[model samples]
Target: MQTRTYNHVDYLWDDTKAASLENDEVALFLYRSNILGSDLRITNYGGGNTSCKTIEKDPLSNKEVEVMWVKGSGGDIGTLTRQGIAGLYTERLRNLKNVYRGLEHEDEMVGLFNHCLFDLDSKAPSIDTPLHGLLPFKHIDHLHPDALIAIAATKNSKKITREIWGDTMGWVPWQRPGFDLGLQLEKCLKENPGIRGIVLESHGLFTWGDSSYECYLNSLEVIEIASEYIEGHVKKNGKVFGGQKLESLPSGKRIEQAAKLAPILRGLCSSENNMIGHFTDEERVLEFINSNDLEKLAPLGTSCPDHFLRTKIKPLVLSLDKEESLDNFNATVQILQPQFEDYRNDYKEYYEGCKHSNSPAVRDPNPVVIIYPGVGMFTFAKNKQTARVASEFYINAINVMRGAEAISTYVALPRQEAFDIEYWLLEEAKLQRMPKEKPLSRKIAIITGAAGGIGKAIAEKLVAEGANVVMTDVNQEALKETTKSMGKDEAIQTICDVTNTTSIEKMFDLSCLNFGGVDVVIHSAGLAISKPLEETTMTDWQLLQDVLVKGQFLLAQFGSDIMKKQGLGGNMVNIASKNGLVAGPNNVGYGTAKAAQLHMTRLLAAELGADKIRVNTVNPDGVIVGSKIWEGEWAEGRAKAYGVSVDELPSHYAKRNLLNEIILPEDVANAVFSLVAILDKSTGNTINVDGGMANAFVR
Candidate 1:
């Protein structure tokens, strides 16, 4: 079991460079903490904490004082800066051990921790600061690593730890993290002076050392030993797969049942005010879900107490037969909704069992993770960031469970302990103190022709405003590049041939699976034909109609269906053209098609208003500023029709407008978003971005 063979890399210390003279302890502490937090296997977004105790000169009295700087509340160690770690007077914090009334509630510990900050410039320290402060060492590292959680969550974890490492590590059974827990840790350390660290049963790992390197190595070495033990156990016992045999497709891919079931799962987690982000599609995740014992194995509890804050104690399990899901959401809701309600009711009863009359009121009873047979596992949360975090921890929890179960059985903390962590004030602060969401935050949007120009511009604006945008275009290569530029976390890309029903349906399905549902649609996809009516071929006219006219019809109808089904009522803005109101010479096809779309906007508004859905049009003129539409032959034809050089055409159009402004695609994009974001009660109306095209004005 003592397999400390993995080489631990010290990424922060540079041999060639001179170390900074100021505050070396705090500097080196952040350096090593960042290295530890950088690896997801060691820690995730906000799952771990690190601390360093040193003597610093107090700015007020200019006197030397013992100080402890730990990762602050809500700070991610991976990106920790000097400001991210709070500097607390170590002696002052320890003094609270006597004055503090063994553990009462109401976020008072958080307040007291805030009061102990050595400097006003420091942020609030973590709740576990007490535990870190009580340890007698220069550096202390606490990591909820997967390997550590694997061994610690086992039934005989304490006995196992004793057998493998002797007294180098002490074991503390589940004690809810607080002042009392800190006192318990102190007592354990005193009783076992030879221990290098302590593994909190059903919790996480703790290690300390006189130097930063010693602490880092101590943690890595001990964790590897535990990892080897589990690895050895797993190699002998083999692995456990869901006992159930999953159906496979002809192509050998597991039957993907997520698209059909996602909407119902999402609706089950929905509330009048919640916008749930749905997550799925990882290979390991899918395989785990396909396992036969999934229903039995998954509900045990969180692998670590900290994980309970996000995933809750257990998830809502959904089972399905192929027949029930064949009809998708329309049929699936009838089966899944009642089960979701039961899950919520059970959670309420579970919370009531621990209701101290002082616990934080129960949050929306919806489970964050929903596990299904064919669909695997999906995470639900109010925003993309939080949902992804939950999914990250949930995936790690599964690995921990598998590792533990491979050795013995995955035993979790008691229900009351799990409830304590879930309701702990520090964790509750994360939920209560969340920053105000953006106007379009948690909303999902779709943009057609999003590869470039106005469609792309609109997508960027909506994404900037906090909507998770799905960008679709006929150009697959361009769509990939577009997705990369927008940051993959919030952008989903797919090819959409708007005129084709199959392609359009696939685009909406992708949106539904990725973000749970769609709340806004901007129909900016279109094509144009510059030839005069006499010069236009029948095929030329038809191709323009297919992309411009038929595309809008499909988008409006399809987008409306999703919104109506969601019953949340959303916004749709059709990017009609100024040519629709005032036809331009040699632009017959483009203008006629755009005109039809403008009319369709009114029709959708009239029809969808009963559901509170709003539909409108943004009529943009001279929005050809940065478009590729002015390239090659298309550019030549447009300039020829205007009797101007290709380079001068934009200037010519600008002069023709009353404001003499060259309208960029972004200008039109702004106009389009204005309709969806600001025009809450106003629809069936057209806002023009034509820079005052007098003749283009509608009566």
Candidate 2:
């Protein structure tokens, strides 16, 4: 088993000194919180709670009183500020430790807790406040760390906890969180007076110390110990079977794809920042791809609940043949329909057995796990960090499950129990507290000329905003290389000859066959050749028309056809040059073709309107450095025509715009995403993304 000792936690704590706390301590707390928050191991927006207790003088009583400052209920740790912490009276909590028997409701216990508010506007105390209050140590920390939860989630969790932490920690089985869990701990503490910390099975870990740093360190140490124990005893062993060679996929394209797919999965999982991870490890890849039990393994729960938030319940397992793999994946989701219905029925029966009439019904019963045969697993989260944290836990959980299978039959959590936890009121409440995200999850988009600066920027921005994008370019090698820079699963690279009808058709077909369907299409692929009107030839016009005019028509045709069949309204944005709107000197073929594109946009919009298809144009002025037109020979001529050096053109163009800044591809892409994803009422309109160049008669 691989192991590394983290003295950083020790350093993290040593640096903080209550009032004399060094800057390092403050920085460490912030850093740790940010990291943990991002990972969804400790917190989600404002889920888990942390606290620091110190002795303060009571002015009226003239006596030292113990006080605790716990995390407020509603603030996200990702954006947490110092003021977000709430000061609560620790002495009152300590006094309530023995009086656990008759607690009926949580509100009745609130009067027993005290706090000094720094800000009156802050929300109510965290639900975990009582647990933090009851701990004896001065500094208390709690997190739903996936590593710890993975081990706790198993059937033999109590035995495993004993084997791992031995006598230093106490284990509490899954119980409804809040006052009940706190009461259980009170009972445990009465029995084992020396217990340093508590492990809430299938939930999280809690540790406390005399100071914030110590508490943080203890928490890390405990989690690291659990991780090490799992790695040693429960981790999966043996190389992945099959002789497949693992090679690193390129980053840019894959990152773009990951960015695009991340949002879709996030939407499906009903969370944002859902984590997605790709594995090309020969052993792991072969083990997943060649597994005869793909269907059986795909429906398993994630390592922890938060993992479900990011990766969902499964991954889109893939094979060398993407089409077949996607088909298999969709089939897998389809096959789960009956199983999900059965599971829901079982859940309803369980609820009826245990719940009162006043209790709320269970949430959706869809399987969160998805399996892509050759691809790695994805974990859903409210955000990317949460997804990643879940992904890490899943990797570990798979290891443990494999190891347990090796040792004995690997029994999963009981279905009713899994359902209970999945629909737990506390977790559901967390969902309610989280901010809502955009609705374009699982939506696929295809952008041509994506290797160009404008294309790359737009592709990246769209993915970041939660759209799965397939980026295409005429340059095959460039397209592949660019995709390598993005993520592999979420992004796709295709060498598309937009002007060729066959190529365009194949590309669209592949997109549908691989993903579900196309939601947005941004046609940015075009050629620009500036020539005097008298000097321009028919060939020049045809080439321009083939790409700018005919290429767009084909894209619109295929996009509209697919969207119509899918019965969902979709949007298309055409990347037109400002020259399309107003004529420019010596721009004969380029301007005419672009003008044709604008007319096509209107025509397509009018024709496809009945199908709920919206068509729009983003006319950007100025050929900056990254645009395909400006990077090649055209740059030299445009610079000469403007009576300026190539280096000065960007500024000159910017000066012509009202914004006095160079228009970026991201700006154009933002306009396109808005038109496609959000703007339902506006169509057949030309949105000028030009810095103000369209209004400037002279540059």
C-alpha root-mean-square deviation, each candidate: 3.3, 7.8
Whole-model lDDT for model 1 versus the true structure?
A: 0.79
> Using Cα atoms with residue i matched to residue i, what is each candidate's TM-score against the true structure?
0.91, 0.67
Query: Which prediction has the highest TM-score against the true structure?
Result: 1
Per-residue lDDT tens digits for candidate 2, residues 1-699, read 113466322223322333453433433454445555664434444446676666666766778887666676656655665667666656666666555445346444554443444234544666677787766666666776645665666668778778777888888877645666777887887777777788776566777776455566677778777656555543454332212334333444333333333223323433222222222223443355445554455456454444444344344443332222222334533543454455446545655665544445654433233333343344433333443344455554454344344333334444455555555555566678666665555567899999877788778877777666788888887777677766644678888988898898768755653454577899988767877778778998899999889889899987776665455667898999888877677787898888898889999889888988889988888857577788655666677767789888898888877778878777887888788767878889888888776452322
Candidate 1's TM-score:
0.91
Question: How many clashing residue pairs appear in each of the predictions shown?
Answer: 4, 64
Identify the runs in model 1 with alpha carbons over 4 angstroms from their true place: 1-4, 7-24, 105-107, 241-255, 281-283, 322-325, 474-485, 610-612, 632-645, 658-660
